[model samples]
Target chain A: MSLESDIPSWVQALAGGGLIGLSAALLMGLEGRILGISGFVRSVLEADPKLKGPSTAFLLGLVLVGILAQFYFVDTLTNTQPRSYMITILAGLLVGYGTAMGNGCTSGHGVCGLSRFSYRSLIATLSFMAAGMLTVTLHRVLMGGM
Target chain B: MKQQITHFIIGILFGIGLLLSGMTQPGKVIGFLDIFGNWVPDLAFVMIGAILINSIAHKFLMRRGRPLFGTGFNLPSKKDLDRPLIQGSILFGIGWGLAGFCPGPAIVSIGGLQTPAILFGIGLVIGASVFIVKKNQVK
Candidate 1:
């Protein structure tokens, strides 16, 4: 079933995706950094004072936009029904551990890694995408609806 | 000083991109991943758009052999295909499929101070922290 909305989903994705790409480019051009949110989030939580400054600033920037969007793009940022806390937290744990262990997430492996044409990234991307698809399939089967 | 400032500004831009792309919506994310179900292909366009621009930028920037602002490009160097890479990613996917929130969206959602996002964030911190501690113990 296709979703019905005022703006087409693909258009939203492509335009927003371009901005994400630009953001990565700017980071590389100006700061010589890969804009991997998982890495930054890990660094912020790691207590390394040296890394704290840049990582914190980057994360804060994301949060700042979040705050601004709450006011400006309220409809765009729609709220979803909360899952059980146990399930939500469990999902968080899996994400945290998985990204940490894998050393990258969607942005790291999917965007930057593939852009660099690393075979390693290709494998990683395929693996995670497959896993996500499988998990969703299982969820739908066992849990009924999401 | 300049480095930190740059990260902050770019981070804001990245966040905005995420919101504009409709990636901030969990339902959309789940829809995209739900190949067996509705199978929304919006996320594929997002990836295609991002990769197309970044690939062009990468070709030029890498040829420069150094970043405009910093000493060198801080790209990942590991070439080996290892177990952790595959296993960790699979695990992350399961979590992502479960909640439809990845690290970026989860963090962005926190700006709104939503309960689910906050809870996920806390769990993310704990999960990552556990890995760090376990690695430290092994070391």
Candidate 2:
């Protein structure tokens, strides 16, 4: 799990970001949709069968990429230090509930929503960022370190 | 049929983008959120690069009227800074900070069959189901 790379992290970030933006652009341009992952998850959960094709397909695509990464880009997708199952599940629960309640996550609000200059997205992004920062700060203080 | 294929392709591109950008890695995500500590600003660049392209695309695509396959753009119309939006975001941030896996990365991880990710995915589904059930009750 080396973070070392020949290319600078910033450049990698930008190129990757461009690909994400391209995904959103193509989805909007061709399908008339916003590529928010949380929203997509919800749609899958509540699929009406008649109109569930796109969401299901999109999710499968994400999964497919994951499988492909394991085979080829293994170095790029390293996992972090393992946490307890309780914490992991708790975090997952929070993410699922929070994204659903908020109606978007980083991709939806931070990327697509902000791209469109939506004030709601901006506020949501700020709130989540602040909360995330605060949580990490508190965790560090309580748990003694990262 | 065509729409589904297009979406699948787009999803693949999006997943690759996440992997390339390091957004799928919890370490990187936590590093970015660790503002006061050894804060990594790499994620910000991801957002900046993405927004630049997306905003430009939105401007042009919106002008084109209807999309290539769909009848109209399915954009969110809500403008109010509502309570659910704020509260939900705060909760989401906490969860994200806890495990450093958001919906996108978690789903991607599940595909990879990682243990932590698989556990998180279960909790995610349960949590999301709670919200859905509650919403139905309210309605």
Candidate 3:
């Protein structure tokens, strides 16, 4: 089903955006850590050996939530074109690398960092946005407008 | 203490935005990225709304000198445009375009256990691991 099949696209889109903002705020307010996925995953992986168990559990909770959503709201979820698993893996790897080198992912920098007015985040976010624009432009040129 | 509280509040608001905008749904994102097959420019509206709200909020925040929770502003110090910056940007762009899910949405999506997201999260973990190791070695 397309976005237009049931609920209005705008309403859905707005709610999604609002939820993201709200969640990030809540995490910060409670945890004091910015909800940057790169950092969160990193901390989970290499956290103190003593904290490893809890860290792993935390990570598991993150995945569990997604799984539950899928189970409960099967119809609302939409799947993208079936690309090869390899391509998806490669993309994820690159993103991981970028987030590490850049010191933050889009959430950490683009949203959280920018909201905090961090100079590093500002540059990173700008770079990320510009790069996205360039990539799409080039992709259209190469893929013939997809 | 105050900073922590602020972050939590900000996180909650951000989460709500994600849910409201349908950003948490991979379909909406993939749909936006699938501009070649069936284009939906509505994603642009979400971006505009965010930018507008953020811009105004930022201005107001700046006027305050200090954030509600923190003693002072927290901003990045790096100003130079260098190799690491450029390369990282390129990598981020490619990942985002291919996956239709950047870090923010990916985290939010985690609340809904989709296969693609799980895969993406795994990849994210491995990628971060490599980066951290390499950084440590350099240091």
Candidate 4:
């Protein structure tokens, strides 16, 4: 049976986006910090004395929440597709590298940036969209329309 | 006082929303990105829904003289397009295309406890560390 039979994918996607946006707003309001993943990741790794405490708590909370969700809601979500694990790893690395280089990720720039009407965010979001388009084009060419 | 609590409450609701939505699934994300293959245009509706909700919130938020928690709106101040901006965009694009997981979804996917998310989170930490160090070194 198709997983979509239970809940429509679009509803799921929207709910996900809303969660991210709302969390970011809350974090910023409470801590006076932007809920940018790149910054959060950096703080955890480098342990900057100034940002260490809050960053660690935030990161731990993030992972903890995920684990809790999986335990309680695994059946609700479909199993991840089996594919080339190597390719997926490489992709993740690239994304990590890119967000670091870009000073933010889609959440920081695309969602928060656009909401704030930051021109820089606009550029980043456009770049993201363009890249998605190009990747599709190349994939089609390589796979002969997979 | 209450504003901070509201923000935290909103964050919890947001997390719940992500759980309800299928946006955390890599397969669904890749499927939507699969334009030339079996592209699913349904994600467009997700974007639309988010935009609609955000639009309403924006209108209400804007009516207030200042944000409840902050002195004013906490928008980004940068406007110029610089090298970091260009290079970072290209990198983000390449990464998203390759992995089908952007930061937002990646963060949410951690809930799945999947291997890919674990690996991705590791890489994310490493990359961010490197960037911070390099940035510090330059100053």
* Model 2 chain A weakest 10-residue run by lDDT: A74-83
Give model 1's DockQ, 2 decimals: 0.75
Q: Tell me what TM-score chain A of model 3 achieves.
A: 0.78
Scored by lDDT, model 1 comes in at 0.86
- Identify the leading candidate in terms of TM-score: 2
The stretch of ten residues in a row with the least summed lDDT in candidate 2 chain B is B105-114
Ranking by lDDT: 2, 1, 4, 3
Predictions in order: lDDT: 0.86, 0.89, 0.60, 0.62
- Candidate 1 local lDDT, B36-123, one digit each (tens): 8878898999899999999999999988899877789887789999999999999999999888889998888899776788888998
- Per-residue lDDT tens digits for candidate 2, residues A58-104, read 88999999888777777656766566899989999999999999999
True contacts kept of each: 0.82, 0.84, 0.42, 0.44
- Per-residue lDDT over B17-70 for candidate 4, one digit per residue giving the tens place of the 0 to 100 score: 555555556556566667767777656555555545554455466575455555
lDDT for each residue of candidate 1 in A1-146, tens digit (9 for 90 to 100) = 11225777798789889999989888888788888888988888787787778989999999998888777776556755356899889999999999999988998898889988988889988988999889888887787774
Better of 1 and 4 by TM-score: 1
User: Would you list the clashing residue pairs of candidate 1?
Assistant: none
In order of appearance, the predictions have TM-scores of: 0.95, 0.96, 0.72, 0.80
**If you assessed candidate 2 against the hidden native complex, which CAPRI class would it receive?**
high
lDDT of 4 at B91: 77
